[model samples]
Target: MNFERRNLSDDQLLDLYKRLLKPRLIEEKMLILIRQGKVSKWFSGIGQEAISCGITAVLGKDEYILPMHRNLGVFTGRDIPLYRLFSQWQGKAAGFTKGRDRSFHFGTQEYKIIGMISHLGPQMGVADGIALANKLKKNGKVTAVFTGEGATSEGDFHEALNIAAVWDLPVLFIIENNGYGLSTPTNEQYRCENLADKGVGYGMEAHILDGNNILEIYNELSEIVESMRTNPRPVLIEFKTFRMRGHEEASGTKYVPQELMDMWAEKDPVDNFRRYLLKQNILRQDKDDQWREEIRKEIDDNLLIANTEADIKATYEQEVGDVYAPYDFEEIKPGSETENIRFVDAISQGLRQSFERHENLVIMGQDIAEYGGAFKITDGFVDLFGKDRIKNTPICESAVVSAGMGLSINGYKSIVEMQFADFVSTGFNPIVNYLAKVHYRWGENADVVVRMPCGGGTQAGPFHSQTNEAWFTKTPGLKVVYPAFPYDAKGLLTASINDPNPVMFFEHKLLYRSIYQDVPTNYYTLPLGQAAVLREGKDVTIVAFGAAVHWALETLDKNPEISADLIDLRTLQPLDKDTVYKSIKKTNKVIILQEDSLFGGIASDIAAMITEDCFEYLDGPVRRVASLDTPIPFTKALEDQYLAKGRFEETLKELVAY
Candidate 1:
């Protein structure tokens, strides 16, 4: 694949120069604003403006763009309002993120700009995802993702590029090789001679262009974008550019030697392009002056508008209530009519019903389709739904989750399987930076269900059997659900699939097949923040979630004399604190039970919340029955000790005695 340079008239060259200069001036003004305290911070693309403007110029306004922090020039060329960019730096509501995100995290669906920020290189995969969606929809649009050379070292970069190339998605990965990442030079970051060469390893077309030359970059990008639009394929272009300024306004360039600075300064993209325009007789001194004045006045006027605009305030108070999307869950009521169904069967049935109702729903993971997931929770799904809806992905956790995020962003309800919950570490980047923050940052719904078969007790060893729900439960903007009974499992899964936010559906491996209850066959759902009161009593309020809920129920059953009210918090993130507090007020005692380690587990969070909100209602110190702080052991004896089964019986008896 090659791009031929287009023969352009002098007028066209002049127009290109004018476009590049606007962003350069805007960046310069922003720097002045930062120094004057009007803007808190600024990242300049002084020497890299040519490549940024060139790429956007070549790409269509309808095509998607996932930009790095320093790609302000690209956004400016794409016509992202300069005032919105300025307002973002000033932490004002006029910004694209309404003062929620930092300045660089600018996105507008109207402009096809998929905003991503500051996570180094994960946006590459997200860009691939957008392209994948385009391919699926047969939309003749390419997705361009911008990153620095240093970002190439991230594992997500490799994963995204590999999948895009293999699938031949219409994605163009633009690496703004600014020679350095913060203080670390590209030479120190990787052994590769050229960053574009890395794309070849993924079997994608790779090109190295003069990032300082706007004409060269525009020529290459125009051809690539056109080719991708017609017969789409993934391509990587390495723009050999330089960061003339520090990484951000807060950074000091003292570590950079004067010699290197001088060397890069001589190759300044803005200056070189200006000289080129002059040489081509495209830009005269008078014409350049007139264009500069116009842009300066336009920026000044926009800045005034942005500064005077009313601020938009957002609070977590609204988010705390109804974190899950509103839906009629009455159709799928909780609790079973019969007592033979197991938790796993309920999960499978809930997913089956949800998928049947929502035609856009997709279920995928390693061995999930045919092998019925590692725990057999998704057994018979492939036979029921076929391969399209029940996809069996290769053993690539990162790829599966990242792809799921992409699908969800594009209006598909994707349920990604992590074989085991412990394996979520493999896809942590996508879960944390992308899926969790997508809504908060871009206001785009990340409606994906991540099914993590978690918890221990089947003697599957430390690798296969571990409860890591706490790891994700701590993250904001993500709902974590763990159902103890078949009824709760069915209801919660239905709620998760229908919800607008990303959900971490933790299915305890042991409880999946072990616990049995009667679940309704009809459509039903349980509200996200609603906790179930399994048994009503007045002695103590036993607050638990997931498998620990069963333990609480069993403990209550054993102690006939010691009456207790059991609250099963199916969702961990948007906790049913109202239910918890009400229960505490009635019982005047609280005990939190959890399956994960005692240190930093869900129990700890619940205990803190109860103490903060309902301390007067408590009769004694809130007790916590959780697993020991150690790795899940292989032996059954150690496993039993590590996990909190019915050992809470002793605690309940002690509490009653107290």
Candidate 2:
């Protein structure tokens, strides 16, 4: 090693070399374990170790890293025990995630590293949020985020870069350009000459470096780290390298040509660095051999221990309780009294109450600050809370949610609003796959309230309006809330904001002005799983939530002769089953209604639960009334017919007469 060129001592170079070799050897052993059927499939960052380790070499001790699967060097660099890492790979209970996760899918709080989900794209935004938090705290530290050349094409990548650059956040975006996204080659992936140039367009200091040269990487990154610590700004560095193995050990590298393989073989990072140390005569043969022997034995023993350790067998009853932060709130208590307020205004009031109660609360979304959101629910928020607390994010749903998750991880309560509930589809991965599973797996706080204006009857077409509560209800680690009246909206949102778990708060856009009641301007919170009795009767029971609650009330009011028990289910997941059961038993004839598509609406789940629980109490078969199983059209007549409220009313009358 030419120590003078890199300004690194022999000991420092040796340490870097050891880190590079550890993951290489770990992968080699992991491949064996995979074939032995003790460990599952593994992602090998074998050829790209230099880039990861080099970046780790320059990271500040207190700084954070949002890492991808292939970045094994990050774990080693962070000083996570090898036994813990190996145990996790083998799904042992003693692992970081306690056997809830697998290979390269674990992180530790002590190290300030975040375990990445398979959809690693959104984490860019998450890292951006972490950097933003650091900036807000005036911490002179930086955050380093890792992704492959493939992940650079994701919208979150661009959105994160924009946020980081625009805010002058201290974040280092490291791209390991190994020329393939799974099986597709880089040439087929993008049109850019150099991926580093993308940073220049974003006004970031961009660099392209030889990823195989660890000494060069350490030397360059050291200066960049110093600059970042003093003057916070985003930087993008592309590490040009090649993947020597398949995307995973199981995914054979048949797509790679022998010529390309031979070409990259000449530049093998581990071998090149070893040769450099040998040439410098700095690698004492006896000491180096001793170190290797100890490493081999340590890895061998850890693998054996990991392969034999117990698997996780905890049930939901044991695991689900602590996923969210323990919120100290009550639903029935009155804070202040208000008369006749719109649902939108009530929601804003609830947010104001949250701000008053919690100093760490932050509200974020597109057009929310200046435009008061798409529905103007946050009309006076930006002016009251200032732009810092009431943030305006760009139109990136995935970033909005993931960044919220990041903020939550750092102890800031995040309240995010989606302009349209239908647009959450654009951010599906982070919400469903990442946020919904994070707390369940790692016992971390996934505390965030995603406020979405949903439902139809606005004539905004299919893309603008949707009832997506069912989508979140099925996702485990998330609490799904859909309130009916202005009272319920204000109460449930307040509760969701304070709860420790991630919540999908669905606000019906139509109900913002249409179906509202006199709501209290108090800071009371409703128990998440409780259902409210809007009306009590005996002939039939109508179970509904959000806009459907209003529809059910309308139907019952119109038909004075047909007495019905109307129940509004405020929270979708962690359902008020006891309330539902009592209502179904009292009425026997049950009707489930929703503004969502009937095919997979929450109504179906409620009906099925009713049949399973109250089968003998039934006076008639359960009836389901929901929107048509097609795109919500723009025309009013078609939309009115499609919602099937009349169909539900006819069914209600039939059941009443029967």
For every candidate, C-alpha RMSD to the true structure in Å: 3.1, 2.2
User: In candidate 1, what are the lDDT values of residues 1-658, reduced to their tens digit?
Assistant: 1222378777767767877899888888888888888777777788888877888888878877888777776678777787777777666776766576786775677777776667766677767667767776787888888878887888878878877876787888888888788999877999978888888688889999988888888877787788889898999998887788888878968778899889988887777778766765667989889889999999999999888987766677754433434335444554455556988888888888898899888887788877887778778878877776787765666766777766776667788888788888988888887788777665777878898888887888888888888888888878888778888888888988888788999888878778887778776888777788888888988888877876776766766887889888888877888898998999989888888889988788889988898888778888988888888899988888888774677887777667
Predicted candidate 2 versus true structure: per-residue lDDT over 1-658, tens digit per residue: 2333456778898998898888887778777878888777788888899888988888876888888888888888887878888877766777877777776665567888987878778888888778877877787888899999998888889988887887788999999999889999999989999999999888999999899899889999999989998999999999999998999888878999989999998889998888788778878777678877887888899777766777678787667664554566555586566778888888888998898898788888888887887788788887788887888887878887888888877768888888888888988888888788887677778778898888888888888877878788877788898887888888888888878888999888888887657887667877789898888888888888887787787777787887778888888887998988898888888888888889888889888988898999998898888889998888889888788676888877777777
Which residue pairs collide in model 1, if any? Answer: 331-523, 332-523, 332-524, 332-525, 333-524, 336-518, 336-519, 338-518
Off by over 4 Å in 2: 1-4, 314-316, 319-332
Q: Flag regions of model 1 displaced more than 4 Å.
A: 1-5, 9-11, 250-254, 257-259, 310-340, 378-389, 392-399
lDDT value for model 2? 0.83
User: What clash count goes with each model?
Assistant: 8, 5
Q: TM-scores for all candidates?
A: 0.92, 0.95
**Model 2: number of clashes?**
5
Overall lDDT per candidate, in order of appearance? 0.79, 0.83
Candidate 2 residue 611 C-alpha distance from true site, Å: 0.9
TM-score (C-alpha, index-matched) for candidate 2? 0.95
